[model samples]
Target: MDQLTPVVPDDNKQAYAVTEVTPEDAGDVQVDVHTHLRDGVQRKMEQRHIQMIALAGTLGTGLFLSSGKTIAHGGPAGSVLSYILTGSIAYCMLTCVGEMAVYAPISGGYIHYIERWLHPAIGFAVGWQVCIQYCLFLPSEIIAANILISFWDQAFPKARQAGYMLILMAFAALINYFGVRWFGESEFVFALIKIALVVGLIIGGIVLDLGGGPNHDRIGFRYWKDPGAFAPYHEDSGFGYFLGFFTNLLQAAGSFAGIESIAFTAAEVKNPRVALSKAIRRLFWRIAIFYVVLVFVVGLLVPYNDPNLLQSTGTAASSPFVIAFNRAGVKVLPSIINAAILTSAFSAGSSLMYSVSRMLYGLALRGFAPRFVAKTTKQGLPVVALSIVACFFGLSFMSLGDGASTVLNWLSNLNALLVLYSPSVGFKLTHVSIGYITWMMIGVTYLRFKKGIEAQGIDRTAWRYYNRFQPWPAYWVIFWSSIVLIFSGWEVFTKGHWSAQDFVIDYITIPIFLVLAGGFWIVKRPRWLKAHELDMFGNIPKDEDVECDEPAPKTWFGKVINFLFT
Candidate 1:
């Protein structure tokens, strides 16, 4: 009976590995070598799969549909600048994540890094933050899809919307159950479809702006002059315009939320070192070109004050894409764009499910959650974790009764505190739309353990990956993220702008995060792991043991796809 129990150890490195002591003929307590115990996830995602995971996880309703709202609020120029600013923040975060993830190459990605490198309590907090964030996020996507369908048929039934969400969630869960390869391949296709939509829209927008389409009416940035490149905010003056720009910047930041998700699959991706670095290298340009540039061009093609831009039509038809095409006299593209948007939203949900399950599995591995959640099938699927995460998808049904915007509001509150961008759709909850996200990031990255890695006798040069500017980006993430957290909600304090809803969205998560982290501090009273005490090698794969598991693509097209995309 004693053989089946695990031994608590003072050393974290020993505590991890999740080694169970089993007594056999020797009647001794020893670590078992079960395959499931070795590594709880499959390394089936290839380089291309990593790229698509990042892309498919992002590139959804936010950029495709909601940029219209962003442009209306910030104006075209303001919106682009905001995107660049936010994209830069995302770049810093992703690179830092890449540097750590490649060196660690763990399933939980940053969550594992937080627990081992910083403090377990903070890891506990972040784990809950991420799980709850995606739980709300997955349903928000479902609700966004429902809103999209209703735009097509404004009277779309609530029951039908709930049914659609359930079907979408079930399908996403099914795809995840097949394991990483299945998820990756499906996401690869999903990413391609999303890229095609954005590219096609850009080309079509260019044509319409230049008056090259069949109707031949030159737009040529006329909207920028009329509605102007700067939209007035709470006031018509310079400061008000700045407010508009800042708000739009926050919204734009929201759009880029899950850019770091590729790291979540680091444990599952083949050749995580190369795969991760490659994904990080190519990501910024895509954000700038596909998101910022496309939003810029959308602003150019359509006037921001167009009635539809202000209205939350809840469908891709309501997207600047459909609005611009139709205004330019293109009739048929809206339906096509809407269809693509629906798929994009669905893709986001799929990615969210995968990330949430894996993150939870990681948490379980760290003993933060039920150990059963860490269990996996022979295929390396965390079935118990997936089942638990999938159950939260029912929250999307909140939209059917209360409305999508309302659910988005509550979800948005938490997400904003963390600078979470839901691909593009808002994470609404209980009629609240959260804003602000940098301080939360600061909390996560401030106690980062790079210096500890050096102390662990690991050679910095030998590390598979390193951020170009080692400590600077980490420093920036710490400083700027905190500033965003503090100032993002400042508008509510203005004399005329105070509102209960605004305060909730702007600041609610701050206290919740503090409470979680603080509560842990109170009970456990854990100190931040100092440099020498960091667990550099805890349950992590040795550098020499790391090797690429994916085979080279065989077909000519496959090779080209891998080369270009990966």
Candidate 2:
């Protein structure tokens, strides 16, 4: 038997080597994929980078720029409940993904898992949908970054905005074009800045509410009471408040959209099992502190009826935190927050571009795309895939046109597809008053994964990371995500609130996915695998995991640093 030619660089050859087996010798799909593709990629992302990259993707403009919209629509209590409800669902869904990602840590993330575990047609629909989602979403983030820069001067002309957009796109392209290491390090720094800003803003919000700010005015739920805990949506009755809460619920989903980037990069992390496990475990706290707490504080500080809440300035000026600070007679914080959000927007765009490129690469590996797209540079950068996906950045120029809002609406409408169709995917859908069919697909995929594992009799103890609550998390996600996906467009159904364009945009993706998936199913006529016969172990690259080991922290300080950073 020919010894497998190790794919690592010369310096790393002694540290990493595969067993004696050629690609042809491996009959299993996983081994063949491993022999051919897995080792071509470099594992440069550290544990800290994995944690923060997930943060970078999730903590973007939705929280900083449009969270105020949630408050304005739902009022303080309604908005808070919306975020809490959505955040819980997101947490559960990530745990399901964590289990699969930690086990295999494959390149394509959940899309690959869905293909192998569910039907390939389902995977095709999902993978292409996500690619479409990010292609549109990447420019939207760049457009958002341009808007963030406008915080300094809302009067900046379209030409100037176009210039800023160009600069932002170039920076994002630079970050991703090099490799995952650059992507990881950049996101780490951006995530830290975002974390600091959100923490400071949360603390600042507390101070402003307690009369500790320059105004010395005690806020203490005054806004909630005056706004009466719930704002009417499209009417001034009981049904109106329900609509308000539901609308905000859908919006909150958008804020949590890109959290699943962790899964996509799992294959590129230094130590997949340990690093991904740490990131997944800490995700709950990150979401609660960064998102739930921040929104709650914003609600306490700003009333739902604040006219500025609807400003849509696309800058810090419209941010609830910024609004609260200004009302408290503090002026300096807005600029600082705006700068941080600008970085956040850029980081999100860069990260989304990187993720979709990897998704396209995975698609190529599955024969869904051209084989040439699967080729990577020596450093394992998917150059062709990156270039293809990066082209969509041109769409950001649309935001500089006379019909900027209309352009954004079109891009956003297409982006409503999910990370697994995360909250961001749901965000685009809800933005147009549409249901989240793609988001529901995530839950269905996870259930299929769970069913396959059980049917195959896989041992739980041997897994790198096993989520504490088994099947329940899958069930939890499916139930609530299904409810939201189905009823997400309920407001449009109200008697006085009908629009054909809105209705079509709301549910259009449903059929697009159905046609793609169904057509693939009909043409290929792929045989369904019994749960016991599923290829759960085939695609897992055990040799890839063996090539690297992260040393444990020895000293107390090292341990503390490891705990905090990891």
Candidate 3:
């Protein structure tokens, strides 16, 4: 058997050895050895694989099921604004993450970055928060899947739900167990189906607007015009409306929670430099086109005050997509939409499990978790960590018996602030880099020149992809994140009833980061920091050292896609 060669310079090399074996020989090895081998090499996920994972992460019950709630809370105009605003924030954060992932794609993703740049305690806390969020997603998805199934037949619905949940989970486990490529391929196909459905819906919506459907009244923005163009949910003058807007903003931000999944997959991606860059570039438009544009079209087609919009309560049947289909008088569309929702939920749940398990594995590697959980399978699957995550998901099922609305609200509240916090803090810290800091300043300058850019009719691909309009999106992130952080505590000061939730969210990020940093400093204080091991914002390497040596595409089709996308 050939030993794996170290990729770094001899002076920087650590005392680790790798032994490779054939697949037949692999089975005969002890489980511990298998685990070690799996954990040894960093699995490089390909471009399509990253795209598939990103698609699965982004298209969830949130778009279908939760968009209505955002509409109801913010009204039609405010809802659209909220999504656009939050989407901008997410876009900026992803760009920052892209730059880092391109530079050094690691399996641990941000958790590893946090550990290397900040401290182990901060990393552990972030890891815990991420894991909790992902695990909670499981039951939420399961309940959603169950509700979708019941739409077909109520007979033995609960049993069907349980069965489907287990089956989907097992399938995810099997895919992951084989290796990264299998998971990527499966996700790719599933994601393509979703993208097609969405595109078809958008086109159908346009046709319906043109009065092509039965009983259609040339629905050319009648909902918007009749509803007074832009319904701002708050009539209160002064800061009151702003306060309401901020609350709605948090909810909107939460809807885009999983956008960071692109960052999570950085480590596993095959060519971090090209693949990560393309993924980040695509992310901006995808959110703008799929989420922002879709929401705009839906709002214009369906009134915000529709009874169904307010009835969501986190179930698939409550989804605006179904409501829109039903409104369009499209018979049988609801069932198709429901089935799509089921697949979307399963994909999201699988993604959650993968993210949480890898986070646990990262934590364990850093000694923050029990060492045993760090063990991996010969195929490079973190079996023990994955099992723990699965168990946590099973435990989340207890929340099912709790009132669905309450459970959903609690989960929503818990996740809303934390979701934006990680990326916000991560970006701000990453901006400590000279080039990134320069971009941040340039982004701010560009925002001031927004009017000029708009006047020039610059294509979105140019403005958003190139960040040409100055802080095209980063400024919004800084502005809104600051508002949420501050005003989350305002009710306590003004109305007297303290919001523990607000405090937990607003104050949690810094302490969590500090504790992690402090712990790492106390324990394994390295004699010197390795350049490759530094966090996003740490000391910038010389241009030569910073260059990435990504592998070439294995096939012609891959090379073409890579060329087009990159």
Candidate 4:
């Protein structure tokens, strides 16, 4: 580590260089990685867009559409409680990520820092896992959009429906092809529409629940009482009720997937430290308001036993939100909500493709993926990575053979396994129930915080963004996360419930990551990284490019919009 070399032509470029990690990876240069793409392309995501992306990415088919399935499995009370608990765990991980993101604000985000603090092999495994999940998710979401479109017109030709998916996928690539700005702006508009839709739905649900619609018959909590707060699946009441709760726990995780996106993509966001701190600070309330509150309201309106919920009709007919509106005789709301669902689902596909492409590029730069994958356009988009991910749209063809419904289930399960590898996901909540992630985050948080103090001398007083409760929250998160993870797959072991597919799907990632990472470590033979030796700032750019050039909104209406959206 002599004097740091410049990564870009302009000295004003961030002080990002090929950092040195453990002495063994590449001797003088740490883990071998391309320094930075300082091609004069600025970080384009505005502070406002940051707020909406976090909200919009998570509010997808899971919340507006699939919540009926969760309610069917876990009942209303159980589902609501599960989201609260799982959301708490996700918050802990997000905050842990936030503390480091503010300090370094790099592209690889948590995984990159995890490699520096934990092991390089672990970092590599996690990064590639993220790429795989996004790769899988990108196509699944496209297929989902196609399915949702069927709700409006069942007679629409399947081939043409698929053609629409391709066109939409290409459009998404173009957004990322341009840069983060396009991705940010597109999601901003998408997220705003969704926010308005959610707000409208909540108000309407409350009105309908109170019998304010044309029917004018106060239903109150009539559905919850008759159906009770719990629903037993095929099993006995005691165990069935409990298993359903576990099922809903995973559901909540799926809904809030990408909780770590803001932290991971901190590199591309302008004013990373301040923007991320605000986003993370507001994250919990967003989950509670958009998800928890919505869940509570939805439960009060729709019963767990609704035939529409249990049928899996693959259309707006099955959505609890739409079901409630239909029951209330609301003429046009269902159609509107269905349309919003389409846009949101499409937006999710695009955003995930964008995220995975960047993750792939980051992996390539770190010497994990092929060097060509890291190749980018002059504007800084990972064009090669984008092309590879976009090619996954070919997977949509699987729907033709097995049917879209069957292929979607397969992709969802695969996405779950990869969730253990990649923290950024919104597919299945049960994935979070696996618990290993919780313990891993706790270990990383504690080790990083301890090492940061002894090594970098970081303290909350000076560091604007730091995880709260210090070493304590990490311990609690580990405790709860472990319990959830162990029992997450426990139902599969039930006497009559054993299913080999369930066991493998739930626990598969544990061995895959361990063996790959362990094997890589053994071969690399990096110096034994001691706890105290962790470099909290090893990868941090020496001089951050501080360009808060976007002018703030000054008008009264603009300020109001900022308060509502941001």
Most accurate candidate by lDDT: 2
| Descending-TM-score candidate ranking | 2, 4, 1, 3
lDDT of 1 by residue, 1-566 (tens): 21222245431112223333322221221122211233457677777888776654578787777788778878888888888877777777777787778776777777777767777777778778768778767777777877777757767677777777778878888898888899898898888888898889888888888989667988887888897998887773448778877777567765776666677887887777778777877777887788877988888887767778765666766688788777767788877888888888888888888888888888887777777778888677889989988888888777766777887776665565653446546333222122234224533553356777666665666765666577776766666667666677778877777888667766666677777878888987877657987655544555444475557799999889977876
Q: List where candidate 3 sits over 4 angstroms from the true fold.
A: 1-44, 234-244, 313-316, 396-476, 489-566
Clashes of each: 25, 8, 14, 7
All candidates: TM-score: 0.87, 0.89, 0.74, 0.89
lDDT of every predicted structure (CA atoms): 0.71, 0.74, 0.57, 0.69
RMSD of each: 5.6, 4.1, 9.8, 4.1
Of the candidates numbered 1 and 2, which has the greater lDDT value? Answer: 2
TM-score of 1: 0.87
Quote the RMSD, in angstroms, for model 2.
4.1
272-351: candidate 4 lDDT, tens digit per residue: 77778788888878888888888889988888888777655555665788888888888787678778888887888888
lDDT of 2 by residue, 1-566 (tens): 42333444463222233556543433222322432443346677888788776654578777887888888898888888998888888888888888888777767888888787788898888788778777777877777777677777668888788788888899899999878999888988888898888889889899889999997999898987896889998784458888899888768877887676578888788878888887888888888888888989999998888888887666777678888888888989888988988888788888888888989988887777887888778787889999998899998787666545566656665554332232321123434321234445566777787777777676766876887677787778778876775676676677778888666656666677778899989988888887876666644656454347679999998698577887
Encode model 3's per-residue lDDT on 73-179: one tens digit a residue.
Answer: 56667678877876777677666545445544555665655544444444555666667657666666655555556667657344555676577667766766666
Error of 2 at 350 (Å): 0.5
Maximum-TM-score candidate: 2
Q: lDDT for model 3, on a 0 to 1 scale?
A: 0.57
